[model samples]
Target: MKIAVIGTGGVGGYFGAKLAQAGNDVTFIARGQHLEAIRSNGLLVKSVNGDMHIPNAQVSDTITDITNADLVLTAVKAWQIKDIRNDIKQIIHEKSIVLPLQNGVMAADELAEVIPEKQVMGGLCRIFSLIEAPGVINHVGFKPEIVFGERNGVQTPEMEVLSQLFDNAGIACKASRDIEADVWKKFIFICTSALLAVTKTSYGELRELKETRQMMIALLNEIYAVSQKKGVKIKPDFIDKTIAVIDAVAYESTSSLTRDVWEGKPSEIDYQNGTVVKLAEKYGVDVPVNRFVYDCILPMELKARGKFNRQTS
Candidate 1:
């Protein structure tokens, strides 16, 4: 398979390396020192499953340089999808599939609005990994699975072929019959955990405090209510299921959003919890918990991006 991995961050770097090691023609689209390091030293993945090194990595910062891709795995931050939509269009043919493996629920829809709907697939990934350095990705935890499918829950030949390709590469993957539900399931957990982590700054601390734990549950319930109002078929017990998943995570595990905020980098707060709040309003479902979390984090997020300015009169 010919694959183009846009945004060689943690998700892209790890999965792209696996596909490349399995003999797929994988092109990593990245920039700056990361791109230079991959070009010179190779792309490295330090994984709990096993470490992988692709020394002869095919990498480029320019999307136009990659003209032939069977599959395009867009792993950029949620806020970056719209910016790269046109750039991605230049590399894909009509038969190419674009799977967005970001943390938000609206990525596939956003991409579809910009690109061809027939080419966009709703997708999400389960992995706790990050770019530890320029050329290295650290897959610290989680089972690391990728779930994707056609937008409307219909199976297609392209989905079958893509599933087989992932299996061949020894990747834990699922072709979901209902990809939207899968995406929302992940969204519920991520938004709740991310907001709690943002406010508390530690997953351990967030989960330990009874008051915070209750707040986390309330946040999850709010997201569930909003998703239900939007007509997404989340399981009735999804809130309990998500809470259990959160409880099982490693004590010190923090979300990428929290890490980004703490490290003074731009994050996807507006796309995650903020999205829930927006949808809640649109659906007439009150999501005070999500709204409060989004409000608390907005100032910090703006500051991280240098958009916050204090006014003194």
Candidate 2:
């Protein structure tokens, strides 16, 4: 399959590299030092599963020279979507499937606002990865799945073909029955973990401490409640299922948001916490825990952005 990855970051690079490794036509759209590295030294993937460097996959700074992508993964950060929309539309053909493997619920809608609605696919990619260096992608943890589907829940030829593509790429991919529920399930856990992790010093400490778990549950309940109020149907035993996952995960593990909070890199608080609050207001529900979680992260926003060294007005 012909695939275009909009970002060469961990999620984009790792998945794209795997797809390319499987002998699929994959183009990586990237720029700056990372782009230069990929262009010169090739793209690298380092993970427990395995690692390899793809020297043949095409890399470009602009989409003007790109075309005919069967699937385009819009893996750019949430904030970059609006800015990159024009170029995104410029590259891939109209019938190409565009999947936004981003956090939160509105990513597909956000892309549709720019791209044609018929081609936008609802996507959820959960991978613990980061750009270890300019040209290198580090895939950590256990989850390496990519789930996506049609907006109307009907399995189209494109979706079936997509499932085949992902499987061939060696990703634990699935075309879900209820894609929204799957997205929300992960979102609930992620938002909760990120919010609670900011309160304490470290993920290990939080998981070991009683208070951290309490805060985690409270914040999770608030987000869960808000999800229900918005009429986004969740699994019948979602709460139990989520709680079970929380208990099963390694205590030392934390969300990338919390990692950004500590390292002082820009976090996805605006989309994660802010989105929950917006839904709360829409549903007229009191979301004090979520509100508090959002408020607590305000000061850390700049810190999460790596702006601690610089002064702010």
Candidate 3:
């Protein structure tokens, strides 16, 4: 199948390379030095599974260059939804399944508002990928999974065909029945993890520090409450289960926001804690914990605009 990977960052770069390596007609839409490097050489995925290089790829920064795609994977950040959304109609085919692998519940809704004709499939991607450099993507660990389904869980030909393509690429993928539940479950963990470790400290520090550990628990609980209010059927004893997952891992696993803040990049607080806050006001569900997180990270918005207070020792 002909595929177009929009926003060739960590998620797009790694997954698109896999599909392309599997002999699919994959065109990566990218820009800047990264696009130049991919054009000169190819996209490189440095993963625990081993390095993968796709030489001689069809790539262009413009949407019209890669028009008529069979499947278009929307991999851009949530903040860029409005920026690149109008291009969807320019490139996407009628039969294409626009999979938004963004980390939030509003992905389908947000994209549907723009391109409702393009079949918007909700994808709750489970991967720990990070862009090591402009042309290099460092996929940490090996367990990368992509679960997607239509807004309604019908056995569509497009969904089935996409599943087979992923299988051909040797990726563990599936067509989920309740993708919203999956997204909510993943979002619960992510919101807690990101908010708890945003203070330039690792999860180990927060878990070891009694005060911060309690705060982490509080944050997790608040997210859980919001999830319940939003009518997402999380697993029973979900908090305990998630905490066990957290405890089983290395103590020093920090959040992406912490790393982004440290490296002076924009964080996804508005989509995360801000999501909960908006829902809290919508449902009249008091989420003090989520509200507190909103307050804590609101100051970081200035960081994106070169206005954050820098601490010096």
Candidate 4:
């Protein structure tokens, strides 16, 4: 398979490496020091599952470097989806599949706004991984897996082929019956965890403290209510299920949004909890907890985006 990976972060680097390792034609699109490092020293993945390296990696800063790619993984931050839509479209042929391994629910729809809806698949990845350094990916926890499918719940031959290909590369992937609901299921955990940004608390401290834990539940319930109003087929006990997922993770863990906020980097705040608040309003559902979290993060988020003028204030 010919694969093009845009944004060579943890998700892209790791999965692209695996696909390349399995002898597929994989081109990684990256930039800056990361691109230089991958070009100079190849890509390295430090994984709990197992560490791997690919020397002489095929990497480029330009998307047009790859054309007619069989698959394109837009692994950039959720907010970056719209910005890269035209670039992604350049690399894919008509039959090429575009999978988004982002953290939020809007990736597919965002891509479909520009790219063909049939080419955009609803997808999400299950892995606690990040770029440790320029060209190094760190996989800390969870068995890495990808759940994706056609948004309309119809299976295609490409889906079957991709499933077998992932299996061949030793990647755990599933074709979902209801991709929207699956995306929302993952959203509950991530949206709740993103609150760590406002609280400046670790997963351990957030879930261990009785008061914070209750607040977390409130946030989860608000998201659940919003999801229900949106007609996402989430489970009734999803809050408990999400809590169980939180309990299983290492307490010291922090969400990507939290880490980005703490490091003063632009983040997916508008696409995660903020998205919840928007959807809630659109659906006439009250999501006070989500609204509070979104409001708390807005100042820093605006500053990161250079929309907040600190000196003038």
Candidate 5:
């Protein structure tokens, strides 16, 4: 299948290379130093799975250069979806499928606001990867996996085909039975763990310390409550499940949000915990824990975006 990978960072770079390696027609969309590096050196993936090089990678700074694509994997930051929706429209035809492998629940909704709702698929990815250099993707941890399906959880022949395509690329992937629940299930952990960005705690320290663990549970409960109010079907013991997942991770592990905040880079604060706070207010649900996390991070987020006036302080 012909594939267009938008935002060729870790998620897009790693997966797109796999697809391209498997002989799929893959066009990578990138800009700046990354684009130049790929053009000069192709895309190099240093992975725990196995390192691979795509010399002569088909790439473009412009999205429309692809002309057409069978699938568009949107791996941009959750906050960036809106900025590229119009560009995305330029490459897709009626049969195109758009899958968003962002960290939050709002990606599909954000894309669907401009693209056709029928073409957008809710999805999430499990991988610890980053741009180690301009053209180098570092897959440092986690066996990569992708779960996606139609927003309504209904299966389609197209879903099956996509699953097979992933399998052929040696990627571990599955079509979700309930994409909504799956996305929230991942969210419950990610949004809660984002607090570590503020506390500067590692996974080991987070679960070992009494105060931090309690705070983690409180944050998890608040997000779960918001999900319930929104009618996403998460199990009652999901908090325990989320905690177990956290405990099993490597001791020093941290979330993308945590790393972004610590590095003074723009983050998905608005889409993750911030989204919960907004939804809680909308649905009349109490999310004080989530509110606290979001509030604490807001200033750093604003400062990173050049929206905070530190001189005024």
Candidate 6:
């Protein structure tokens, strides 16, 4: 299969390397030292499942460099989707599929707004991985699976073929009959944990303290309310189920949003919590917990981008 991996970050680098290792034609779209390193050395993945190295990985900084992709896996940050829409559209043909492995629920919709709706698929990934350095990706936890399907729940031959391609690369994948539910299921966990992690810094700490645990539950409940209002079919008891999954993870586990904040980098705060808040307003639902978290992190996010204005009293 011909694949274009936009944003060679943790998710893209690891999956693209695995696909390339399986002898598929995979082009990694990246920039800066990362692209140079992949061009000179190789795309390296250090995984708990197993390490992989693609010595001759095809990589490029320009999106137009590869135009005949059968599938385009967009792994950029949630806030970056709109910015790269034009670039992505330039590479995909009419038959090409675009799967966004982002954390937010609106990623597929965001892509559909720019690209053809027929070409966009609802998708999400389960993996705890990150770019440890230029040309290097580290997969720390999770079995690393991808769940995706047609936006309208129709089963297409392309979905089956993509699943097979992932399977051939020894990657766990599922073609869901209801991809929206799958995306929301993942969103509950991410939004709750990510917001809590911003203040607590560790999953273990959030789960241990009674006050923090309650705060996490409150955040989850608020998000659940917003989802229900938006007509997403999430269960009422999803908070309990999501908390169980959070407890199962390592105590030290922290979300990418938390990591990005601590590392002083721009994050998807506006897209994740901010999106929830936006939807809450649209649905006339109160999401105080999500709003509070979003407000708390906004200053740091703005400062990271050199947009924050400090005032003197």
TM-score for each of the candidates: 0.97, 0.92, 0.92, 0.98, 0.97, 0.96
In model 6, the runs with Cα more than 4 Å from the true position are 311-313
**Model 5 alpha-carbon drift over 4 Å, by segment:** 310-313
Off by over 4 Å in 1: none
lDDT at position 264, candidate 4: 89
Worst 10 residues of 3 by lDDT: 192-201
Give lDDT for model 2.
0.80
Total backbone clashes of candidate 5, pairs 3 or more residues apart or in separate chains:
0
lDDT tens readout by residue for model 3, 1-313? 8898988887898899999999999999888998998899888899988889998877899877876888888888776776777887678766778888887688788888888644888886777787777678888753888998877666688788879999999888989888888887778777764555355566667677788778778877877887887788787698888777666555666656567656667777777888888987877777787788778777766777678788999
The order of the candidates by lDDT, greatest first, is 5, 4, 1, 6, 2, 3
Give per-residue CA lDDT, model 4, range 103-206, as digits (tens): 88999998999999999999999988899999999999889999989999999987898899899999999999899999999988899656898889999999
Give the CA lDDT, 0 to 100, for residue 220 in model 5: 91
Kindly give the stretch of ten consecutive residues in candidate 2 with the minimal lDDT sum. Answer: 195-204
TM-score of 5: 0.97
> Best-fitting candidate, measured by lDDT?
5
Q: Write the per-residue lDDT of candidate 6 for residues 1-313, one digit (tens) a residue.
A: 8999999988998888888998899999999999999999999999998899999888998888897899999999998899888888988899999999999888899899889999999999999998889999999998999899998999999898988999999889999998998898888788864565467558888888888888888988888888888788877887888989888998898888888887778988887888888989999999888889998888889999999998999
- Give candidate 4 regions above 4 Å deviation: 309-313
Model 5 agreement with the true structure over 104-177: per-residue lDDT tens digits = 89999989999999999999999989899999999988889999999978899879988999999999998998
Model 1 per-residue lDDT tens digits across residues 163-282:
899999999999999998999999988886556545664666787889888889999898889888888988798888887888888888887888777777888998999899889889
lDDT per prediction?
0.89, 0.80, 0.79, 0.90, 0.92, 0.88
Candidate 4: worst-modelled 10 consecutive residues by lDDT = 304-313
